[model samples]
Target: MSIAESVVRTIEDKGAGAFVESYDPAEENMVINLGPVHPSTHGVLRLVLELSGETVLDCRPVIGYLHTGIEKECEDQTWRGAVTAVTRMDYLAPFHNEQAFSLAVEKLLDLEVPPRGKYIRTLMSELGRLSSHLVWFGTSGLDMGAMSAMFYGFRERELFLDFYEMVTGLRMNHGYNIPGGVWQDLPEGWEEVCANIVSIMPGRIDDYESLLTENPIWLERTKGVGIMSIEDAVRFGATGPIGRAAGLDWDLRRDMPYEAYGELSFEVPVASEGDVYARYQVRMAEMRESIKLVGQVMEKMPEGDYKNMDPKIMPPPRSELNRSMEAVIHHFKLVTQGYTVPAGDAYAAVESPRGELGAYVVSDGGTAPYRCHVRDPSFINLQSLASMAKGGLVADLIAVIASVDPVMGGVDR
Candidate 1:
């Protein structure tokens, strides 16, 4: 019988006290609520699971519990202000959100970011990638009941967070990557700090690998659990580590280079396993790659303007404002009214840690976006949950959710 039919029959039998004398196999079929508030779900995601005994027969992910309507709110903010809204979506990898939005606005304005600005943006992007993967590693370990891995992952992640605060003045939701370029240049002593991070990060990754990569329990829980074939991944629009784990062999950094990514060289990690373990392996390799990218940025760091100096788009420096009445007036006008873009629309994407994070913006010759939308990977990737969760034991559902790593802020936004 269908699960629905089984449920009806079981309920009918229960009302008549049929179970007082005998039990029915159909009674074994059950449905359960997994989240919207539970730990191991990663965010405010609700999964309605249909089960037969301990095995999941079907799974449905219900989202929007954390929705704040940031996308719609973007329509009300000025071009320069929208970055603040988008940055909050992923929260874990806010730089990618800002990068995607900034790139789109720049495209709309036909603006160009200088070499130094591009490099700085690239530097932060990779650092953000490292921070994001570290959280994923820690949380994934937590989901798998490996307490030590969580401690290790977060310990290393704190270093990157320090770097973020030094650069952006805030660790998360930093409106650092503006439309013209970055809001400011790298502060003094940035080189020493960045060098210090890359120096220790590789060894730290090795530590993580040693802890969980070959642990028999880790392998048993993740090796063959939550497998999603490459064909299914593509159809469901999975990307980043999820698609890479399935052997999709595509990465926007390499395939569709942007910012300073084209100038830098790094391998896109891919595996054919398409299982929970493969997802873990790919992200671990990516953290190593991000470290390399950060090192490259430090060595090839260029000297130039960090933000486009367009008087209409960028406000005058505070130093200049005190010296020149013209600078003061210009700054006042720009801050109050903001710059306008020509009538057009554009879409720009960056390979976020989650996947292809894209921002689409439309201009109506106004200070604010006429329309704005983001193709958030977390939201798209959540589609694959049903496919991966079904036919797997209920205990393995946590691993599957962690492997996908959907951030609800991005998903619901």
Candidate 2:
């Protein structure tokens, strides 16, 4: 039977008595409501766990607390303005969100990003992945009672955020990515700056691993907990480290090359153990792979236009806007009215830090999208909660949830 079918069967068989009861049979079932406010839920996620003492009988993840009508909001904004809305969907990995939206827009325009632009994008996206994993490692450690790991992970994450701030002027919600290409070119000395980060991060990753990789406490908490096989993961649509940890060799960057990823060299780490430690190992190895890609980007850095030069699609150069009336008018019109796209539907998928984040956009040859929806991986992957947590102790529930690393913003958006 499929995972969904199995879940229904389990719920039907085991939950019939509980449903008939007027109130939760607290003493009999040992029912516990795990956090609509719990920090480990990632954000406003609640799990209604029907349990007998410490062992979970069934699990239902409760979401929708952070929904902001982002898809509906996109309908009101011009295509250019819609990036801001989608970027907020996966706040931790906003670059992937922007990349998916940009890819869809590029498909609509029949536009091709220049080699340099693609390379720069790959660099930034990998950096964003590293930043996101750092947050995951930090917060997961905090959830598991390793407080110092949180500090160490965030300390390393700040370096990447500093690089982002240097490039985009904002620490987060950087509207740096726009349709056709990025908003601006890489700043001067950007190569050196990126190289420096690449040089230092591997050792820092080792530091993080030193704290948790073989530590007896961490191993006891994570190893052999929340195990899920490759078949189970694929059936449930899990991706990124969650799927990879189960020996699924699926990564959109490699399987479906988007942007400049085809030219990059990096390993997709997989662990067959399919446990919480395996997930942790996959993410740690991915951090190293990201560092390798950053070095490659710096080595092959090309020189070219960052944004498209097409006047209709891209904004005119600032120099042209100062001296040319035509340039000023074009810029004004593009910003205020936005460019139109062909009437068609397109989908773009990127391997977000959490999982495979895909955007499906439909355009009716208008400035705004006819319909916009995101296939948030966290939302889909969270469905496997019962599969992983079914027979595990309540304590293991926190560890399993942390390993999956569901961002509620992505889930509820």
Task: Choose the strongest candidate by TM-score.
Answer: 1
Per-residue CA lDDT of candidate 1, range 74-118, in tens? 989999899999899998989999999999999999999999999
User: Per-residue lDDT tens digits of candidate 2, residues 342-379?
Assistant: 99999988888988899999999999988889999899
Q: 392, model 1: CA deviation in Å? A: 0.5
The parts of candidate 1 lying over 4 Å away from their true place are: 1-27
What is the C-alpha local distance difference test score of candidate 1?
Answer: 0.89
Q: State every prediction's TM-score relative to the real structure.
A: 0.94, 0.93
Candidate 2: pairs in clash: none
Q: Model 1, residue 120: displacement in angstroms?
A: 0.6
User: Residue 327 of model 2: what lDDT?
Assistant: 92
**lDDT per model, in order?**
0.89, 0.86
**CA lDDT of 4 in candidate 1?**
35
